[model samples]
Target: MEPLLLGAVIVAAGGFAFLNGFHDVSNSVAAAVRTRALAPTVAVLLAALFALLGALLGTSLAVFFVGAARGLPPGTNGLAILLTAVVAASGWNVLTWYRGTPSSSTHALLGGIVGAGIASRLTSGPAMEGAPEGFLLRLILPLLLAPVIAYLLAYLAVFPATWLLRHASPARVNRGNRMAQAVLTGVFALGQGLQDGQRTTAVILLALIGTGSADGVGIPMWVQVFAALLLAAGSLFGGWRITHTLGHRLVHIDPMRGSTAQGVGSAMLLVSGIVLHLPLSGTQVMASAIVGAGANQPFASVRRPRVVRVLLVWLGTVPATALLGAVLFLALSPLLQS
Candidate 1:
């Protein structure tokens, strides 16, 4: 690849990472803002700091999991696939955010990648061994399962915690739970940094390898730190649209319920990061947890229809973004080559 071409690809990938940060920071700050644990600006600032820290610390595993082992090969096709994926995902995120819908940024990216991968395979033939299955099992499966698992855990956990705290004075319980909420929010931020930040790192590394700037074996420390910082800075800007959607509109939340939801969501994310080696969506996990927590409240307190609409969007994210990515890649293929 020409130096200019490589530079263009790198800059494009960095832009994608920035967009990813802009779109997904809500996952880290929404609960905190909703429960009044922090003001929106303060919450975003804190989450951004933690997210950067998490990204810098955990980018190596991400490089191995998504860049080298996944479907993308080290060349123009891979670069195109990654670029298309980010564009499609970021576009969908902006659309949903504008509508005040809290969709999963992780799923959007995953779907885009899948779509781009399949399109690339169809057009170029398979360039590497076991690419398809690797993507399906490693990337797609976790994207599907993380929310379900989070929902169940949150439902079960909140009910018990509610029961245990039921007899306490409302004011006292609220204060204690507020403190707990802060801790849980921090955990969620950490998980977001570790998992979501890594997805950007992996994609950027894929671009680097494709351009022959680095082997796929390991990401450079500078790349890891820089990517982390970019994402963190993006998070600092925060997505107020999504913050309103997930934090307030999805369901009404008290401190206890918010804590329970954040705690379970964080746990689910960390588990996925460690065991599955996949980037799971903190937004989806937190949403599921919120829904589950709401269900445990009184029947009248929960908003069934609203929850249903969000779920519908969640289900559609993968296929919708996948189709969009495929189409975009197809349209841009000639231009990319030129």
Candidate 2:
């Protein structure tokens, strides 16, 4: 692979990481800010710092994601496929953020890879090997199961959280929960970085492997640093549109319930990304948890219209990005091949 092409791949991957942080990690702080647990600026700053820490400290997810790229076409063709996938995922992320809908960045990238690989095979006779089966068992199964699990976990958690604080006065409960939520939001952001940062690392690693610049045994230190910094930088900017949708439009909850939802969401990310090495959408997990916690409370009610809208967008994300990826690959094929 040419130096220019490799550089292009790295730049594209960086952009995707940035947008992932912007669209997804920023939401981790929404509940904290919404419940007045933390000031908006302070929450954002906390998220940025922890996300950077999580990215630098985590490596298991990067190793797992790289396995998914083993089927890319070798050499420059592989770089093009990777680039198109990142662009497709990034584009979809921006659109959803602008529309104020929460969608899964994980699904978008997976779908993009599938679409680009199929498009490449149709035109050039090479596709992502074992894509359908691998996606079903490894990616889709976990993603499909995660939100349901997150919802249930959050719903059940509310019972215990509320119970423990039942003897306390409302003012005391509110004050204590605010402090708890501030901490939960930081943990949430850390997990977000741990999960999303590895994605960028995997993309850049694939680029290097395609160019024969590095063996694919492990992630390079500089790649991790670059990915970590870019992800954190993106978090600094934040995505307030979707944050509003999550914090205000989707559900209403007190500080205790908000903390419950964030706590559940944070635990889900840590367990899935680290323990199981599974890919999950922080956006989807947190959104579902919020709804789950909100619906269970007698004083709280979910906004059905907003819920439906967000759900529809979530369901459409993968297929839409797949088509987008295929189209992008086809349009850029000549340049990619040359």
**lDDT per residue as tens, model 1, 197-286:** 777677667777777787777777777776788888778787788778777776788888888888888888777677656668888888
TM-score, cand. 1: 0.90
Off by over 4 Å in 1: 67-70, 121-135, 336-338
The C-alpha local distance difference test score for the whole of candidate 2 amounts to: 0.87
Worst 10 residues of 2 by lDDT: 127-136
Error of 1 at 136 (Å): 2.9
Which stretches of model 2 miss by more than 4 angstroms? 131-136
- lDDT of every model, 2 decimals: 0.76, 0.87
**Per-prediction TM-score to the true structure, in the order listed:** 0.90, 0.96
Per-model RMSD to reference: 2.4, 1.5
Give the candidate number with the greatest TM-score: 2
